[model samples]
Every structure is written in structure tokens, then in C-alpha cells.
Target chain A: MTEAVLKVENLQTHFFTKAGVVKSVDDVSFEVGRGKIMGLVGESGSGKSVSGFSIMGLVDHPGRVVGGRILFHGRDLVGLPDEEMRKIRGRRIAMIFQDPMMTLNPVLRIDTQMIETIQAHEKVDRETARQRSRDALGQVGIPSPDERLMAYPHQFSGGMRQRVVIALALAVNPKLVIADEPTTALDVTIQAQILYQMQKLVAEQHMGLIWVTHDLSVVAGLADELCVMYAGRIVERGPVGRLIDAPIHPYTKGLIGSVPSRNPRGQPLTQIPGMAPTPIDLPAGCPFRPRCARASDICRTTPETAEHLPGRFARCFHPHLEDAA
Target chain B: MSVFILRRLMQSLVLLCVMTIIVFAGVYAIGNPIDILISPDATQAEYDRAVRALGLDLPLWQQYLVFLSKLVQGDLGKSFVFNEPALTLVFSRLPATLELAFAAMLLSIVIGIPLGLWAGLRPDSVAGRSIMAGSIFGFSLPNFWQGLMLIMVFSVFLQWLPAGGRGPTANFLGINSSLFTAEGWQHLLLPALNLALFKMSLVIRLTRAGVRETLLLDYVKFARAKGLSSRRVIFVHVFKNILIPLVTVIGLELGSVIAFAVVTETIFAWPGIGKLIIDSIFVLDRPVIVAYLIVIVLMFITINLIVDILYSVLDPRVRLADMKS
Candidate 1:
């Protein structure tokens, strides 16, 4: 197998609040190879976003990576100093946020921000930076890149702002881009366009990607590999096609089944009855034990990530595909 | 954009007219000018002659018209106390006040903003907490008291500097190297510190809040993930976001700095517009009072206009939104 560009091993990120410590990301492990796209899927509070944040070293005060090893190209990133981390952040690894407004500062012109972003990672003159910024905006399918760069964040519609944000992410041409629900705020139509652009860039640049979101449909359309998280831990890991065709964990099955189009027109859409349980007061055993349909006495104890097939992994007392035989 | 500017200008004119009416009414309500005109030694005939010569006997409408016309022609009349044109007195004193306000603002931003950023980025650290505590204390303490304390420590105890005044003597023109010659800076230190202390606490508190808010945004996280150094992330990505609102605060504070100079000047015995206005008020110099009021109001309006223009330049969205609004 090609060496992994990024490897997160047994990571646990906890939030220390007045009430208690919430295990936002607990013992989650995954890998993304060069130019590969990993789809991270889970409901809110499943720790997918937190895991991405941990890898980025963006966790702030009161929330910390208590135990974990974030290996970026074989180098441990967990304990790396902020000064060193900054050198890697925008240059080698980049991130796209959910809200495009966050990515584009409201006070700065589009061109100014994009040019500055380009020059930040490389030693370049204004003309070169401007050309690169224009090219980036063009790559993201922004029409009339020259005029648009002169405009402000408020001038653009929600979708356009998102596209501008995507353009900014592409400015430095980083090797890895972590997109945390980048299209969640965009309309469905705009979402499709952005997704297409993102996929095309990753393929063209051979950059590794971690796409975090709760929407499985988006993952199905975009990701090469899939990892399903519950509470703060990954419950299943496999090829995207295999996971979609035959998901092993009950939690993964429930999620896939819950999709509206997954069922017949006349039938009721599947729903995970209760809200996502709080990470602060997670139940004993598997984090999904409270909602798992196949839970038994054995499930009361925390289950470890166990390999069920040649390359697929699931954290369950009774693996579904194995039992199907 | 031009339309927006035109609208703001019209509004400013209307505001100025309204302010003029209020000032006129206040000046009239204070009492008749007979006491000064007709001293005990003067007879009724002499009093009448004095009143006629002063145009005091003219109808209120006529007096207002004359005053407005003179104002339109850039003639603010003569100062009763200074025996000079009101505009000349204001213009001369204006530089000293502007210098103090500019000095104070520069000191506040230079010292407070960095401290606030440090505090925000490391909320749990000793440096962060100490900065927060200092900010709170600075904001809470009365300006007068702080000015007194500074005077006591820097002037009385240390005897390293002059207690107050524009300079050792007001004979020097602008850019006197004597101030930079070591001895002159010593004279400026106390007044600058006094003005700065009053404004610094505010900048620190506001900056802390602004930084904290910016830190929460996804772009900051994205910046961090991209491996930008903490300084770059905080100053470049985060500072721009925080500084938008900060600029607004700075503009408003500048107006207050001019208005509040009365107290600061008194404490430091500095020769600025505030002291000039105070002395004019005590002497009941009508032309000086009216000229001072008009000058201060116009200063505020112009500064706000500049700030408004800056907003559009900084964030394209704002200019776009303003067009629609």
C-alpha cells in the first residue's frame, strides 16, 4: 500500500466543561493516502468534526487532545509547537470551513485576501499573486474572476461566497485539504457544483482529502473510502462501495437506512428515534449501545475496532456480515 | 457608492443644522448680555449705544442669519477671551488636541491590541489571565485617578519628566527634535501616558472580545490547519476580522478623546483644545463657545464619514449591502 499522507491513531479529544469532560473524539483512527479522499460520516456530536479539528491542531482551551498521535507524512503532529504547525497549515495542508463567510473576511476585498493568502505560503510579487488568485477563482468556476475579486463578501450570494471560500482553499495548492461540512450551508444546486469542483481539483492535484459531514449521500457521491463515527469513535471502516453495498455495524446500517431515498416512495423514511446522545454522559459498552438494534449483554463493555473482512473493520460484539453466513 | 455617500452627507448637514439650533437656544437661555455690556458706571444711553454696536439689539433671526453666513464663509468670528478670530484660536489649539488624541490612540492600539490578542489565544495561561485582569482593572478605574497615579509615579516620585503642558515652552514649531533629543520625550511622556491609560483599557477589552469571536470562526481553524504560524493565524487571519469592529471603536473613541480632553488637560495642565474650551466657558466667551461647539461637532461627523468609507473598502459585502439598503 502507498504510504499514508496522514494517519490518526487512537485519538481522544475531550472538552473540559463546568459540568464534566465530554469525550468529543474518542479512540478514532483512520488514514488517507496521497491523492485519496476519505469520507467521514456521522450524525452531529459523533466527533467527526472534532477529529478533523484535532488533526488540524485547532482545538482551543477547555477542549484538548488528551491522547492521540496525529502522524502527517510519518511525523508526529500532536505535540508539535504552534510556530511549527503554522508552517505546515496553509502551505502543505489546508482546510475549508462550512460557512464561506468565515473563510472570506467581510472587511477585505476578494482579490486582496486571495492574493495575500497566496503570498503567505510562497515568495511572490503582487502580479504573480494576483494571477494565481485569478486562476484559483477561475478553477472554482467563479465567472468574471477579475471583477468578482474587486467585490466584497456581502456582494456575493451564499453559493458564490462558498465558491470564493473554495477558491481561497485552492490558492496555496496544499497537498492535503480538510473540508469540514463545506457545503452544508449552501443550497443543493450550489452544493453539487462545489462538490464537482472539489473532486476535480483533488484528482488533478493528487492531494489527499478528508471530507467530514453527516450527509451520507454527499459521501456516496464524493469519497473513495468511508468511516462511520458514533459518539466520538469510528464504528466502521471500509471501501465506499463495500460500506454502501453491505455495511456491517448496526449504527452504519441505521444511518444508511435512515436516508429518505433509501426506502420506497410509499414507505416511511427511517429515522434514528432519539437525538444524538451527549458525549458528556455517554453510555457504558459501545457508545452506540443505547441505539443499536443488535445490542446484547456483551455490548455493555466497550467494543474494540475488529477486522471483520480482508480490509473492512467494525467495532461490534457481533459483526453483521459474519453473522449473515 | 456615490449615492450612498451623498445621502450620508445630506444627513450630516441636517444634523449640523439641528445642532446649531440647540447651541443657539442654549446660549440664549443662559441669560441676556446686559450684565457685561452695562457695567454699574455706565448710564442707560451708554448701555444702549454699547448694545447697538454689539448687534445685541438686533432681532434673534437677524443674529442667527449673520452667524450662519459667517460660518458658511469659514469665519467663526473673534474670540472674546483670546482677542483673536475664533477659528484662529481653534486652529491653533486644535493641533495639540489632535496630537494628544492621536498619541493616545496609537499607544492604546500598540499596547492594548497585542496584549488582548495574547490573552485571547491563551485564556488559561498566566499571561492571558493577567492581561484580562489588567484590562478589567484599567476599564474600571476612573481616568482622573489613573492620571493622578501616573503623575504621582512618573512626575512626582521619579522626577524623570515634566508634570504637564504641551512642552517646556510653547515657542517651538511642529517636529521639534528637542522632544526626540531625549529631554523633550520626557516632557511628552506624562501627557501621552495619561491620555493613553484612559483609552488603552477600552481597546484591550474590546480587542479581547473581538479576538475571541474571530478565534471561534472556522476560517481561523482553517488557517491553523493550513500550518500558518500562530502569529500569522492570529495577526493575519484573526486580526483582520477583529480589527473591523476595532476601527469603528477607534473612530468613536477619537471623538470622545477630543471631548474628554477637558478633564485630561486639567489633570495634566496640558495646553490643548479642551483647556481652551474650558477657559472660554468660564469667561462666557460666546463666540469661542459657539466656534468650539461647531468645530468639535464637525470633527465627529467627518471622522465617522471616514470610518464609513473605510468599512466599504475593507469588506466588499458592506458596500454591496449598503447599495441595496
Candidate 2:
């Protein structure tokens, strides 16, 4: 793999709510090399989305990055000034949200939305910006880009809106993009089309992507690597094939087992034993220990992330080595 | 588009008819206009002649039929007090009322939106907190008392502006318009400010709430991710989202200011419709009351129709084609 475009090192993002400090993303670390697609798999509130937001510096008030370094191409972004951070955002690293319906400004024309995005980073004439915006819509497979550009967001169908949003993201030629479940709200056929377009776009642009989602099948098909998050920490990280076929962490295994096709018909679907823990007052050790069959006294103490195989890491005392064999 | 407008116009005509009926019946129920019109010292013969000439001798339904017939023929009847066409009386005062309304709205929008945006964006800042506290005062104070206090500060204490009455004026719409002259603005300033206070606060609160809420939406975060400056995010993205609600409230507020600015006009002795209507009500001049109310209804209908069109323009999702497709 080429030099990583983004390397998040022991990053900690906490939400200081009235209740307490919520460790939304605690010591989360990963690397996305150029042209690579990494999936961040987790249940809701497991901090996968927060991790994506942290990278973009899009975390709102009461939620802040508390510790760790986010090294983007060797520049530490953890404590960078807002103005400096603004330069890298959208220009170098862009994001796609979960809901396309809510992502575009409802009142603005599609052309206005796209043109402003391009002009936000670069000092260009409106016509030039508009032309580039038009080209981007075309690039994203939107038909008759001219008319669509003039239309408002609501004029488009659900799938078409998502495509426009993607076009908006790609308009500036960003080097990396953190897509937070971009295809989750789309129809099955639309999802496939979006995924195909995204895969093609990534390869064509040589851009790194971090696909944050809970659906194992989506990442399994699209991502080269996967990081499974549990209670604000990564439980397992490896190449997609290796992690799916031989999940070292019990949480990853449970997630994989919970997929309907993996479970036999005419029976209750495989289920995780407990709900995902709230970020505040998480367990001292592995957050998933209570739900694991292999939990032991040693599991009472926190386990460090360790390599179980070449390029495969898991934070567990009782790694499922036998599953691989 | 023309069909939509035609449908709206048809709906408005029905509304106007209903409004006229309600106002006419409601005003008739208030008291006998004849008692106020006739002198108590006059003999019985004089009283009967006055009542019959004015159509007070007829039943309420029959009088309304007479009014409807005259109204269709473009005659709104002459004011018994002013001895001018009641429609003309109301319309002459209209320019003055409109000038004051426009000034108040301009002040409301210009001050309210920016202050509200600041308060919402930096809610925890010292200035932001103070701005919010100030808005609370704006909401809490009685309009009459607030107007008096402003007079005390600017007129009585500071002696910065006039306490009452219209100043040097220029002709507009073939009537005296204070808006066209500089000294006219000085006289307008205090009254317009007094009138603007409540609406300004409302706009501030509404805009602040919108900014607070919209700042958290997925689109806002996505815009930041694209590396757009905070200014772009706030002004372009956040401002546009909030505008839909702002437009709605401002439209209603504009109608209220134009029609029911009795307190401010009375306090400053401004020559506007509010004073005219109040005098007509006191004298029980049915023609003037009915004409004034009809004009108010038309104004409200026009504003509401504009708001409907703006709704489609602002948010495409609410439009017919968007909803259908």
C-alpha cells in the first residue's frame, strides 16, 4: 500500500454533557492509504460516526476532541486552529452524510449549492465555478446535468438527491472522503448503483475513503479493510476477507453471525446478548465482555490491541484463533 | 405557474367575501351608529330623518345587501365623520401606515437576524448570553410601556429624537410621504423603533432557534467537511435553512404592524390608519369601520398569498411537482 493519506493515532473525542463525559471515540486509530476503502462497522452510539466527524472537525459543542493526534499526511490536526483546519476540509478531505434528503440546503437551487461549494475553497468566477459544478453532476452519472443543476434539491428523487450530494462532494477534487453510511437510506438497486459509482470514482481519483456503516454486507463487498467499533473503541481491525472469515473479537463474530443469511431459516435470527452501552460510564475493560461467551477473569482488565496474524489486530485476551484454523 | 396563481386568487376572492360578512356583522353588533351620528338635542323628526337617510332604519341583513351592491359598483360609501369616500379615507392613510410598517420591518430584520445568528452560533459566549437575555426583555415588556420607555430614553432623557408627530414630508402616491425626506426620518425613527421592538425580538428568537437547530443538521456538518469557512456555513447554509421560518413569521408580523399599530401610532401621534380606525370605531362610523377592516383583510390575504408562493420558492419539497415526482 502507498503512504497513508490519513492516519488517526490514539484519537480521543469526548462529549462533556450535563450527565458526564461521554467517550464517544476513545483511543481510536486507523490508516487509510491512497485509493483504499476502509469500513468502520458499528452499532448506533458505538462511536463510528463520531470518528468520522472527528476527522472532519465537525464535532459540535459539548463534544470535543480531548486527546490523540490525527496525522493527515504528516500534519497533526488534533489542535490545529479552526482557520487552518478550514483549508484542508472540503479541499483535501470531504464527507458524505447518511441522509441525502437532509444533506442539501432545501431552499437553494442545486446549481447554487454546487457552485458555492466549489467557490468556497477556490477564488474563481461564478461562470467557471458553475461550469465545474455542471461537469461534476455529469461525472456522478446525473442525466441532463444542465436542467438538474438549475432545479432545487426536492425536484430530484431520493436516489437522485444522493447522487447530487455525491457530485457536490467530488466537485472540488478532494483527496479523501469519510462517507457516513452514504447508501444506507437508498433503495437496494440505488444502493448498488451508488456503491458501483463510488468504487469507480475512488479508483479514478486515487482518493482514500472511510465508509462508516453497520451493515456487514456493504463493507464486505466494497471495503478492502474493516474496523469494527464497540463502545467507543475498536475491537478488531484487518483486511475485510480475513476479519470476516476469521473474526478474532467476539463482537465482530456476533455482528457477522447476526446477518440473516448466515443463520439457518425457520429459526430465530442470531442476536447479540445485550444492547450497546452508552458512552458515559462504560466498563473499565472491554465494553463487550458482558456479552461474550469467552469472557474470563483476565477479561476484567483492559486488553491492548495486538496483532494475531499479519496485518490483523484484535483487542482481546481470548482471541478466536481456532476459528481461523 | 399561472394556474397556481389563478387558484390562489380564486381562494382569496372567497376569503375576501367571508371576511366582509364577518366584519360587517360583527361591527353592527357593537352598537347603533345612528346614536353617535345624531345629536341628542335634535327633535324626534330630525332623529327619524337622519336614521332613515343613513339606512339605519333597515334591518342588518338588508343594510349589508345595500353595502354589497354599492361595493360591487366600486363605491365603498362616504364616511359620515370625514365626509369623504371611506375607501379613499383608508387608502390615503395607507401610505403613512405602509411607510411606518416598512421602516419597522427593515429595523426588525436588519437587527434581529444578525443578533439572532450571533446568539445561536456562540450561545455560551458572554455577548451571546447577554443578547439572549436582551431578547427575553424584548418578549416580556408590554408594547405600550416599551414605547413609552423608548420615548423617555431617546426623547425625554437623551433628547435625541422627537417625542411625537409626522415631520416635513414629500408627495408619494399623491399624498404626503415622510419616507422621502430626511427630517421626516427623524420623526419616523422613534415611532418605528417603538413599533419594531416586539417583532425584532420575535425575529431574533426565531432566527436564533433556527440557527441553533440547523447548525446541528447533517448538511451543516457536511458543509464544514467540505472545508467551507465558518462564514459560508453560517450565512449561506444555516441562514437559508432558517429563512423559511423567518419569512413565515415576518409575513405575519408585517400584516400586524400595518393593520394594528394602534399603540405606537397613538404614542408618537403618527398620521397612520391605526389612529383613523380607532377614531372611526369610537364614533361608530360603520362605513369607515367596514372599509378599514376590508382593506386590512385584503392586506392579510395578499401577504399570506405571497408567503405561500415563497414557501414553494424556498423549499422545493413543498411544491406540487416535487411532491408528485
Candidate 3:
């Protein structure tokens, strides 16, 4: 088996708001192997984004990683100094954000920003860095990258901006790239193209990817493994095919059933009852108990950890597949 | 790009005209046209002659047209008390004010940004909080009070520098007064430091806020997740976004650097344009006041233009289809 390029072990992140502490990412763990894609699928406020932030060491004031081990290529990253982390970032690992503007420097031309991003990691002259930047831009399917590089971020369409951001992430050919819903802001057509480009780059470069998004369809097509998060905890995990085809957790089942394409035409869609539990005031035992259709009296008192399958893990008092026949 | 500039220029001209009208109305409201030029004991003929000489007998519209034409010819009329051309007086002192404004702005950015970056990168730590508190104090304290405190410390007690004035009287223009000579720079140090301190606090606090906000952006997290160093996360990903909003404040504040210098110059007896304006206001020097008004307006318009151009250059979304083939 290939070695894992990124491993997040027993991570916990909390937000100390004025009201109370919100356990945004509670005791979650996952790994992405070399050249593989790991999908973190959850709804808004489910802490999927928080988990990504924890891994990146980007948690801000009032929100912090209280406990965790972020292992990138077998090195601990939790308390690493910022200067050292900077060297590793963009060189060995790269990230693309959901908003292209966030990833870009608005006052800089595309070429200038991209070239600077590349040179930040590598010791290359201007011409060499420029060439790499051009190649990366073209690889992401930007037309006439040379000319486009002279333009600023405001000149590009949403799709094109995302493409530029993707190109920047790939410029250094890093071993790992974390994409936080990179195409969420784009139109469907553009989203498809970006996804295809990202997949192609991951394959061609043999790099690991963590694709964080709520869209199950995108994850289904792109990810090798899937981790379903609910209320800051991993509710279910498995191979993408197995998880979607035969989901174990009730939440996962509801999520899959609720997808419009999965239901019959004009039929009432299946949705998990109840709202997502607030991280600040989560119920005892399993976080999903309030909404879990299969939940029993025992689910209210004691949390259950799924017996790890050979290659998958889920947390539940009563996983469905074992009794599904 | 050209269109953007032209649009801004037209807007600036209209704004300037409106500002000039406001100034004229303010001046007209203070005293009757005849009263401004003739004594109470003067005969009716004397009053009439003075009114006609000043074009005060014309209709308001005609008066405005003459004012506009005179302005176009670079004549702002004579001072009511000093009897000097306003344009000449304003022009003569323009360089000194520009120097002060430039000096203050440079000081603010040079000291504020790095300090704020350091404070933000470690918000929870003692050193970070201390710096933040100091910056807050700097921002909150009145500029005049800060200037006085500096005078007490550096001039009265320490006696390390002169109390006030542009430079030593000896060889005042003998290459020593131009910031080139050691003595000239020494003389400038106190005023520059005072200006820097006053504005530095504001920019620092602002930068801290900007950095803190940018820290949570998904792109910054993505960069961190890529195992990029904290400096890169802060400088490249975080700082870039932080700087965009900060630039607006910085540009606007550049005008204030001159405005605020009035107090600082008065305290130190520095020969900057702010002091000149104050002197003109006391003597009711119309030409000097008008010229000062025009210069101030021009400064603000130009700074805003630079900011807009900068935004378009840095952000691709600002430009339309111009960059695309």
C-alpha cells in the first residue's frame, strides 16, 4: 500500500465565543494516501471547514486547535514554527480556496502573483519561474496564459479566477493540495471543468488531495475515500463506492436519499429530521441522536464507536449495513 | 485602464468645483461684500468703489464664472488681510507640506504593518496582546497630546534635538535644509517621529484587524494546510488580502497625514503647509486659503485614484474583457 501523504490524528478544535466554547472539530481523524483523494462531506456549520482549517494551522482568534497531530509526510505540524511551515507550504503542499479572490492578491497581475508563489518555495530565476507559472496556467486550461498573466484578479470571470487559483496551487508541484470547495462559486459547467482539471493534475503529478465540500456528487466522482462529518464528528467513513452504495450511518443514508437525483420524479424527498446540533450545546452521547431515525434509548446515554472494518470506520450504536441483509 | 482613469478624473473635477462653491459660499456668508473692504466711517462712494473693484456688485452666477476663470488661470485672488495672490502663497509652501505628509505616511507603513503582522500572527500570546494594546493606545490618543509628550521627552528633558523649526538658522538653505544633510535630517527627526507615532497607531490597529480577518479566510487555511510556513500564510495569503482593505485606509489617511500635521507643525514650529494654512486662516488670506483648499482636494483625489488603479491591477475581477483574448 502507498504511504499516507497526510494524516490527521485525534484532532479537536474549539471556538471560544462570547457565549461559550463551540467544539467545532471534536476528536476526528483521517488520512489521505499518496496520489489519493479524501473527501470531507458535510453541511454548512458541520465543522468540515473547521477541520480543514485545523489541518492547515489557519485557525484564528477565539478558535484554536486544542489537541491534534497533523502529520504531513510523517512530520508533526501542530506546533511547527511559522517560518518552517512557510517553507513547506507551496513547496511540498499547496492549498486552493473556495473564493478565488481570497487566494489572489488583487493589486498584482496574475503572472506576478503566480511567479512570486512559485519562487517562494523554489530557488528559481524569473524566467524559469515564469515558465512554470505559464505551464501551470495552461495545465488548468486557461487560454493564452501568457497574456492573461498580465491581467489582475478582477479581470477574470469566477471560473477563470478559480482556474488561476488552481494553477497557482499546482505551480510548485507539491505532494499534497488541499482544495476547500474550490469550484463551489463557479457555474456548473465551469465546476465540471475545474474538477476534471484537478483530477488530471492529481493523477499526472501523483499528489494527494483533500477535497472538502458538501456536494456529494462532486465527491462521488473525485474521491477514493469518503468521510462524513456531522456536528464536528466523523459519523461514517468508507470507500466512496461502498459509502454511497451502502451507507452505514443513518445520517449518511438520509444525505444520500435526499439528493434529488437519487429519488423518483415528483416523489417526496427523504431528509433527516431535525436541525444540525449546535456545537456549543451539543446533546450527550452521539451528536446525531436527535436526528437519527435508528436511534434507541441507549443512544442517549453512551456513544458508540464502530468496529473498524478492514479499511473503513464509522461511529454509531447501530450501523445499518450489518442488519440490512 | 484608460477609461477607468478618465472616469475618476472627471469625478474629481466635479468634486473640486463643488468644493470650491462651498468655500465661496462660506466666505460670502461671513461678511457683506462691501463691509469686507470698507471701514464703517468710509463714504458710500468708497464702499461702492471697493465693491466694484472686488466684483462684489455682480450677480452670484457672474461672480462664480469669474472665480472659475481666475482659478483656471491659476489666480486665486488677493488675500483680504495680506494682499498676496493665494496661488503664489499656496504654491510656495506646497513642498514643505508634501514632505511632511510623505514622511508621516512612510513612517506609518514602515512601523505599523510589521508590528501589526507580528501582533496578529500570535494573538493569544502575551507579547502579541501587549503590542496590540500599545497600538490601540497609539490609535486612540489625540495627536496633539502625543506631540506634546514627544516634545517634553526629546526636547526639554533629553535635549537630544531642537525644540522646533525646519532647521537651524545658520546656512538654512545651504544644502542642510533639504533632508540631505545630517543636521537637516536631525532637525526633521522629531517632527517626522511625531507624525509617525500619530499615524502609526492607526495603521497598526487597522492592519491587525485586517490580518485577523484574513487569517480565517479559506485560502489562508488552504495555504496552511499545504504545510506552508506561518510567515507565508501571513505574508502571502493573509497579508495580501489584509492589504487590500488596508490600502483604502492608508490612502485616505495619507491626506490626514497632512491634515494632522497642522497640530504637529504648530507644536514643533515646523515650516510645513499645515502651519501656513492656519496662518492664512487667521489673517483671512483668501488666496492662500483657496490655494490650500484646492491643494488638499487635489491630494485626496489623486490618492483615491492611485488606490483604484492599484485595486484593478492587483485584482483580476476589476478589469473586464480587456485581458482576455
lDDT of 2 by residue, A94-173 (tens): 89999999898777899988888888889999999999999999998999998888898778998999999899999999
Of 1 and 2, the candidate ahead on lDDT is: 2
Chain A alone, TM-score per model: 0.96, 0.98, 0.96
Q: Provide fnat values for all models in the order shown.
A: 0.74, 0.89, 0.56
Output the number of the TM-score-best candidate: 2
Candidate 1, residue A133: the lDDT equals: 87
Q: Output the number of the lDDT-best candidate.
A: 2
- Whole-structure CA lDDT of model 1: 0.81
lDDT of 3: 0.79
List ranges where model 2 is wrong by over 4 Å.
A266-269, B172-175, B320-325
Q: Model 3, range A1-325, lDDT digits (tens) per residue?
A: 3699998988999999999999999888889998899999999989998887676666876799899798998999898877776677667777778887666655557887777777677779999989998988888888998899888777888999999888887888888888888888888998898889888888999999999999999999999999999999888888998889888788898899999998889999997899987778999988888888788988887564564565657888777867332
TM-score order, best first, reads 2, 1, 3
Q: What is the per-residue lDDT of model 1 for residues A41-73, given as tens digits with 9 covering 90 to 100?
A: 988888898888788788876899999798999
Estimated TM-score for each candidate: 0.88, 0.94, 0.79
Please write out the lDDT profile of model 3 over residues B81-154, one tens digit for every residue. 55677767777776666666777788889988998888877788898899888877776788788888888998
Candidate 2 TM-score, true structure as reference:
0.94
TM-score: the better of candidates 1 and 3: 1
